[model samples]
Target: MPETLNVQTRDDFGKGAARRIRAEHQIPAVLYGHGMDPLHLTLPGHETALAARNSNALLELVLPGGDSHLALIKEIQRHPLRRTLTHLDLIAVRRGEKVQVDIPVILVGEPTAPAIAVVDAQTLTIEVDALKVPESIEVDVEEKEEGYQLFAGDVKLPAGAELVTEAELLVVAVQLPRVDAELEAAIEENEAAGAELGADAEDSEGESTEESADEE
Candidate 1:
């Protein structure tokens, strides 16, 4: 079920207005989709933030006049340093309607001994019901041996969901971790070069002292 939020229409515009709205513990947002004209709205900051925790959260926005619309978070802008919500762009959606979204990929269980599972793709694009979008899609790596590769097509998606990503796209790879011998050798060579330079500097200083004594 979609989270319900009471929202208000706003006529204010520009950065100044947005800041003022945020100062009042509200979020500024715009809703656009389905060929409708864009609607400027103000949403409660705390409620919207909680719902946004799930990237593909479906929200039912209630207007002051009792009209409501279902919306999907299309984009979010945040403060770079503070990580606070700055603004939002929403797209109107309907329940049961299919929407293309990027769902986070989660790896579950461990691979075979000496083999580690590495995620090649962080998210998978899928077409799923807007109201039924999942929080994440889990990929099983249990007992996977080294050199095992899982592609997007191998992923099992939620019921009725369709994969939009290329089937051949790599999602996870199980491999044995090994150190680079060439890199290690280069580091050792550099250390040896520094030690030789130090010895040459010390010998040069000793000769200078001996010459000073001879002059005496």
Candidate 2:
């Protein structure tokens, strides 16, 4: 079920008006789509904040005149320092319609012992029912060996969902844990330095031999 919040229509505009709205503990929002004129509105700050926590929050907007509309949060503007909401951009949506959204991908279970699972992509773009958008998707890596990799298309989607991201996009890679990751790096640097020194020494020795041979 979708979250429901009562919102009041607004005629107020501009930064000054928005500041006034925020002072009154409300969020200035714009509701737009489906060929209708944009609806400027104010939503109670507390409720809006809680509902906006989820990326794909499906809100049933209860208007003052007893009409309601289903909307999805498209964008949220926030106060840069304090992290308070400044404005919201909501897009009207219809039930059963497919919408493209980025859903979080979570790793589940442990990969093969001593191997770390590195997630390359944190979220995946998918087309899912507007009303049934997922909160997150899980990828199980239990017993997966080192060198195992998972790509975007390897993810299992909820019913009626379709992948929007490229199929070849890497999602995760399982690799042997570098308990000595730093140590191994240091070793490689030292080996490279040693090789350079050895090469220079050989060149010097060759020059000395050539000088002696020329003198002879």
Best of the candidates, TM-score: 1
Candidate 1: regions farther than 4 A off? 178-190, 209-216
Evaluated with lDDT, which candidate comes out highest?
1
Q: Could you tell me which residue pairs clash in candidate 2?
A: none
Model 2 regions lying over 4 Å from their true place: 177-180, 183-216
Clash count in backbone of candidate 1: 0
Q: Please write out the lDDT profile of model 2 over residues 7-56, one tens digit for every residue.
A: 99989799999999999999999999999899999999999999999878
Instruction: Give the range where candidate 2 is weakest over 10 consecutive residues by summed lDDT.
Output: 175-184
- Per-model TM-score versus the true fold: 0.90, 0.81
Q: lDDT tens string, model 1, 1-216?
A: 999999999999999999999999999999999999999999999999999998888999999999999999989999899888989999999877899999999999999988889999999999999988999999999999999999999999999999999999999999876556668889999999999999999999999999999999
Alpha-carbon lDDT, every model: 0.95, 0.93
